[model samples]
Target chain A: MGEFELIRRYFASAACAAGAEGVALGIGDDCALLAPAPGEQLAVSTDTLVAGVHFPEVCDPFLLGQRALAVSASDLAAMGATPLAFTLALTLPTADAAWLEGFARGLNRMAHNCGLALVGGDTTRGPLSMTVTVFGRVPAGQALTRAGAQVGDLLCVGGVVGEAGGALELVLGRQQVAAEIAEPLLARYWSPQPQLAFGQALRGKATAALDVSDGLLADCGHISRASGVALVIESERLPASAALETLLGAERALQQKLGAGDDYVLAFTLPPRHLAELQAQWPQMAVVGRAEAGEGVRVLDARGQDITPRQGGYLHFME
Target chain B: MGEFELIRRYFASAACAAGAEGVALGIGDDCALLAPAPGEQLAVSTDTLVAGVHFPEVCDPFLLGQRALAVSASDLAAMGATPLAFTLALTLPTADAAWLEGFARGLNRMAHNCGLALVGGDTTRGPLSMTVTVFGRVPAGQALTRAGAQVGDLLCVGGVVGEAGGALELVLGRQQVAAEIAEPLLARYWSPQPQLAFGQALRGKATAALDVSDGLLADCGHISRASGVALVIESERLPASAALETLLGAERALQQKLGAGDDYVLAFTLPPRHLAELQAQWPQMAVVGRAEAGEGVRVLDARGQDITPRQGGYLHFME
Candidate 1:
């Protein structure tokens, strides 16, 4: 099939959310049209995934497609915005019908779950890569920012962390873990679920907010640096999954959970007095630590002992 | 330098016209924020450039940076929207400070010229490539599209064509052209000037419009197929440069000129009766052809003889 037909048949048919309030016109157009609500502003972000770099060359195409969109959505989640639409720029060596079919299916599944519509993009012949740019809307001044945290704010995180890092270790055969333990961890690494709803809930409450993409310690450090405060993460309180305990043991797993990346969970700060209200809305949150009047991050054990690890977090270029 | 510093020290300084007009915030944040005019709508387009595909591997870094952003902005021009802001995703094999400096300089020059600001994007270690997504604003229902052409509308082109293609030929050493002719052509190919003002002027006037990125015949074929009409080109009327004429004699130049790509010129359909008003506004426009009652494209020389070329235009995958 030609370029236009390939786009319409595989891409334009992706499952989108029911309503079209923000999206004025969707796929199959020269450009996408969007109109934010009267009182809302637009938030935009973009990311690119390259073959053999961002993911393994032999990895599942379907999951890669889903993860590609999810990573960009994670940025919107970091901003506390409601998703509206997205555009994709896809480059491939050839027009492989089967690959396109599987990729589109994965893209549609994730897009529908996030309440986003596929708008406009381009397909070209080149080395394999995909670039997704996502849009979201939020009330003016309501979007969370990493620079808003105060020294006295409580630091918190949503859901489990470090499962994606453990999954990568298993995938690379660096560890001798069982498939049953490895399978779910691998899935988490491949398809991270961005905490969109949780992020929106922090709009007016959280002093600072960002998605934990690089790792707990590193990402939280971003908030501290931007907000000009010190972050004290309680190492013993770091959330860990059962799979992580079974594979890496509780001690090393604790470190992995703290330093591993690709966990698209919202990490935010709130006033100590509003901790009850935060828990009322989100029961899954863990009070990881607190912000202090200083610079940089410090990790403390349950006994109040400083237990900072040697490395900060994963660096893609160095790895 | 690390990713964050590389961006702040180089890429974040580009000026965006929209940022001053209530973009609210941009770059250096989790997500870029923009407040649209009360009634205006947003138009978005994305394009990716891979190393050895969209550009040569050994070209000047500054030019590559300028061209990557320019190509994406060309999409905004096609939709008859005014450029607001843009995001950049840069993937590099390693951290090359000199390359980043040159690229950012080139990108900033173009962004300043177009009044667009760099917002938020991702930077990762991977195969070398750059993806730029541009945002523009247009009044509701005033955006130009490919489906608005009527059978009797006149086909017009904004400026010179085939210079870029001829320049590429010279660059690849497929032909030995003089420096005087080669430099101008190469400049046109590497540093295209997007017709932003012209496109904005045509918003309520032109029937349909698109940038000539994929050759005249193929790009016009998009309008013909979308508008459900045949597009006939008067070959003798095609605007050709003296460099193109000198490189390939009149006959061959006409063929290459009709089927060459990367010109970044605007092609649109206008009502014949509006010629006087259009000329008064956009005197640079040159009438070259007209839409017909049938499907497909037909080319005729000065003598009314068929001048249809063998292979009509460039195909991305075939390259």
Candidate 2:
């Protein structure tokens, strides 16, 4: 198909314009034009997912598209920014019309769900890879950072974690699980909903915040190292899904939750005094642990014994 | 090395302060925050260059760094926008410290030259590739568009074309050329100067503008087909450089200039009446052709014979 036809068919849709407030020129132009809000600052992040490296080569393209955008948007969520616009650079080995349609459908579905618009990008010939650069807007002094955790703050995470990594294990044939349990696990692996609303909710209240991309323990360690405060994530308090428990078992689920990656859940640190207020308004959030007065991250079992893994989580390059 | 320390050494040098119209947050964070100018809109574009696809695998990494940023920034110039910042997604086979040093050095040098900051980026392990998403500010309704060219507008280009493609041929060992000529050609391939100033100058003057990326014939064809007007470029007046002529022979240079790609120079259309005014103010610009009442792009010889090539220029997927 011609470039014009491709832009019209796959790239132009209402779903691509959901959160594009400042986008003056969207998909039809040589470049996308966006006017940022007068008082708000823009937040930008880019991530690339390769066919075999980041996702399975034969996985659902729709789910892959959704997860790719979600992972990149999670970075924006981590900074307490509201999602706005994103550009997708799609490189393919060959142009398969059916593949394009399916991929775009998945991307559009997720784009609508997450409230982000597709702006401008390039399509090229290469091995299958998707690079999404997402933009967001946050107020001047309120963006959450990795370097803001206070010594005595409460460490929190939204919703459940470890399901995604556990799901990936099932897909890789490292574990065998029934469809009843496997469905939700696969969904978690494919469709991570970045905690946009919760992150925005924690803009001023959360001292340090980040998305749990590389597992709770590893990502929490990033905050600890950045802020020079010790963090304790209690294994007993960690949330577990029925799917995670079925596939990974209780103990293994806890281990995966502590050491696996691609959860995309929001992990934040708040002052202990604000815990009552946070819980009053948000029931989904749980104070699973606390930030202590030193450095590094610690994981404690039900009886307060150390259960921290020697290697915190996936060291991306090392893996 | 630690992830944070590696980031500090290789990525942090590319960071810049957002200044008085301050950034809510800058580098070393999950994402960077940027405040858009009061009455301005942000123009955004994304492009990815992959090893053994976009460029030769053994080509200089420093040049790859410069060319990658230049090519992506050219999209902003084409839209007549002033660049502000960029985000990079860097994927590599391994964490080659020396390679990263050179790449970052080249990127930092080009960032300084273009007056853009490295806002945020993700570094991961994969096949070597880089995806850079650039942002620029332009006044509402004033940015040049490719669909605005009217019949009879003069087609002009900012600089010489074909040098980059010519350099590629040499790099691929298909052409034997002197180093003196090859050095400049290679430099042109490695580091394309995005004609931002010239593009901005044509904001109100030119009816339509875009960078000659794929090639003059192909890119001008974009304007011609989009605007429903035929663009006729004269062979003699196609802004052939002395260096190019000396290297490729005059006839070969003319052919290369017609179909060569990656010359990140502005190609625009303006009314003939504004020609004198444009030339008086912007002497570097060469009025090489004219847009007509018909469709498609055509080249005119000394006797004004139509000399359009069978193939216009490079198409990413096809090539």
Candidate 3:
């Protein structure tokens, strides 16, 4: 069969490709038409994942599919937008039918979870990689950006961090552990649930927000630079999953929580007045830091001394 | 320097990256915010071009950048949507400053010409490839689609069809010709102008439309299938550029016009009553044939004899 037929069979027939709200037209067209509700602005983000670079070259297609969409959707969550539609540009080395089937199933499952419709995409023959461009809708002036944090706001994280970072060892076959410790970490790495609902809940409350993909200290620096305020992290307050702690012990887990990347948990700045009410609703939410009247990011140990790492997190293409 | 700095220097500082009318927030954010006109629907399309598969691996980066954006922007033209903003997910083998500089210049030039702002995108290290997701806006219910052709509507193409196809020989260094004959053909291959204005003019007039990427015959088959009608093409009506004819001669040029792809020209079905007026506005618009009450696509000779090829255009993965 032709690639066109392959795409139609694997993707066009997926459940999320069916007509959905906000999508006036979906697949099988030159362009997909989306009508955002009146007074809402469209939120758009694009992310590309390459084999070996972003994920294991030889890995489960189903997991790869899930991780790809989740990583892109996390951006919309950071913006406090309602998920609407997405386009996937997939490049594969070959047309492996079994792999495509598994991938599509996982992709559709995540699409359902994220409330995103598969509006359009292009499939081509090349290196194994995919670019997912996600679209969402937010009220005209209510999108949560990294540029709104104030000096006196408390810096917080929505969920556990560093589990995905610890899972990388098992994914690369460099380490092995019992399934009890491994499963949760791997699941966090593969199927991270973008904190969509919590981000929406933060629209009027959070001063600034972003999904953590580049470690706690590094991502907090983005908020600092964008909002023109400094961020101070209390190292003892960093949240690390039990799976991560079990896999790497407390000291290494603390290091991962501070410097490892790829955790999709949201990190945001919130005024002190709104903290109590929000914490009541979101129990996992932890206050780890605070914004300061300065520039750059700093980390503090329990002894009240600065312990910031010289280099915070991973930087792609840094020689 | 880091990848983030590379992106900021090469892309975020481009002329098109500055604040634009429709874009509320651009680069440096998790997601860009775009506000369309109140009654407009967003037209979104994504296209990926892999190195060596889509273009010569050692070709000019500047031309590659121009071709990539033009290829994606053509879909918006096909839908008669006004160009607004685009995100480019570019994966490169390395951060080659010289190549990136040239590529950015070319990309910025096309973005300016097409009136598209540089929105949010991700730059990563991987095999050389790029996926461009473009967003445009058109009045609700007025965007042209492939599902609206009537039985008697005339089949039309906006511009010259075959120069890019003929240029493939030169691109691959398989053919040698005079500079005069080669320049225009190569230009078409590297930077085929999308018929944006012509497509906008066709709004409310053309019944169905799409850009010619897959060969004319194959793309027409799409409209035929979608609209549930047969498209009959008069063989002699296929538009071949003078340069293409000069390079490949009449018969070969005709073949290229019918069977070769990557034209980026607008193909649409229009009622006869609107043809004269549209043709007057768009001098290059040519009426090639008519839709019939049937299925599939056919090509007929001037003698009215059925002469359709057994296979139409290129299909990506057909062994």
Q: Which runs in model 3 stand beyond 4 Å of their true positions?
A: A13-18, B13-18
Tens-digit lDDT track of model 3 for B125-193: 899999999999999999999999999999999988978989999999999999999998899899878
Candidate with maximal DockQ: 3
Candidate achieving higher lDDT, 2 or 3: 3
What are the candidates' individual DockQ scores? 0.61, 0.62, 0.82
Docking class of 3: high
In Å, residue B105's CA in model 1 sits off its true spot by 1.4
Q: Write the per-residue lDDT of candidate 2 for residues B142-188, one digit (tens) a residue.
A: 98988889987889988788788777777788878777888898788
Chain B TM-score of model 3, please? 0.97
In model 2, which regions exceed 4 Å deviation? A2-4, A14-20, A272-281, B1-4, B17-22, B272-281
Cα lDDT tens digits for candidate 1, A42-72: 9998888888877777777788889999988
lDDT at A185, model 2: 84
The lDDT-based order of candidates, best leading, equals: 3, 1, 2
Per-residue lDDT tens digits for candidate 3, residues A33-143, read 999988999999999999999999999999998999999999999999999999999999999989998899888889889999888888888999999999999999999
lDDT of 2 by residue, A1-319 (tens): 5444564577576234324576777765668887777777788878889878888889877788788889988898898898888888888888787888878888887788878888777787777888998888887678898989988788898878888989889777787878899988888888898888888989888999998877788899889988999999888888768889877678888888887788888889998887888788878788899988988888899899987888867765653
Clashes of each: 3, 3, 0
